[model samples]
Target: MGALAQLLPLVRSARRDQDQSVLSAALQAFLDFGIKRTSMVEVARRGGLSLATLYRRFSSKSDLIQAVGLQQTREFIEGVDAAVQQQIDRDAGAEAQIVELFVAFLDGLRGNRLLDRLLDTEPEIVLPYLTTKGAPVIELGRDYLAEFVTRLQAEGKLPAYDPLPVAEMVARTALSLALTPQTVIPLDDDIAVRKYARDHVAVSFRVPVTDS
Candidate 1:
């Protein structure tokens, strides 16, 4: 009986993986051919599945887009955690470590096709997820920043401040700059943005910006 139960979960998980694969393919098709241009039949074709199968998993295109956006957000947070772990293991300086993790998070978002489409081409799909108070993605970002800042303060790397509140403010400010139309931060200008984020951290913690 226990073996049967374990096997049942594995079977359910496999089915779930298959469903996600179909959805991922549909998302790629949507990215390639805009939301309005893509159709359910086309997505199924791109996914190498039957229309019935696709519709069974995602009732509509809008639903699929939302799922992809949420998945992207989850993956992005995981990437940020990995980057933070990597930086800490290397004993990176406090400010440098924070900026590195922040940049990694931004980079992950930039590479997300669903998010890119929503941000750059379809504001209708993007605005709700970003603006909503209880949105999962926004909440994850806020929580991650708050935790990181708190850790820094606890480690004596940063001054004792209310990390959650400060991190929330910083996240909001950064999001505003990034999401604003016609305002692009070129991370490629490597030194400048790095210096900018680092300096902001220094000011926030009331620490001197060191010349490294």
Candidate 2:
């Protein structure tokens, strides 16, 4: 099928085999020491595998990082999908649903210890993945949100629009808030963040009101 469709099975297989452990070890090392400082030896030691095995599985450090990134992105998208579906099932209003979806996403990001460590100690390693070379993950997030928005439009819960552009706006806005929140806003406050997202984002997607 598609590239992502083809990659899912490999990711799932990695989760089932020693490759998962190796990737986990690499991720842990990268989070702790930054990718540049972390070596293949350290990854092998952390994974309890021989360097040969690590090399055999992944040709280089970049390959391992790419694999880890793909897996992480997949899991992140799955979590967002679940959160959005849960809100939809609750019969929440369109705005409320979007708010809850973003809240859930932000909560996940806040809870990720690896992300916190990377942000605090090695922001450079993470910046590229979010900015310059972030096409894969960004596309994943955009496509997922676009599909969700399309569903809402089909159900008459949101206005009909080109879901891709709208989803891109939503994804980029959410990513910005998650990564570098405005200094003036109390982004650390979950309640305030939810309110801000609802006030700002909901308007864009909400069905326009007309005088009866």
Clash count for candidate 1 is 0
Clashing residue pairs in candidate 1, if any? none
* Candidate 1 CA-lDDT value: 0.63
The lDDT leader among the candidates is: 2
Model 2 C-alpha lDDT per residue in residues 60-157, reported as the tens digit of each score? 77667767776776677787778777656546567777777777777666666666677677788777767776666677778878887887788777
Write the residue-wise lDDT of candidate 1 on 166-204 in tens digits. Answer: 666666655664466344555656577677667665466
What is the RMSD, in Å, between candidate 1 and the native fold over all Cα?
7.1
Candidate 1: worst-modelled 10 consecutive residues by lDDT: 4-13
Could you tell me the TM-score of candidate 1? Answer: 0.68
lDDT of 1 at 69: 56
Residue 195 displacement (Å), model 2: 2.9
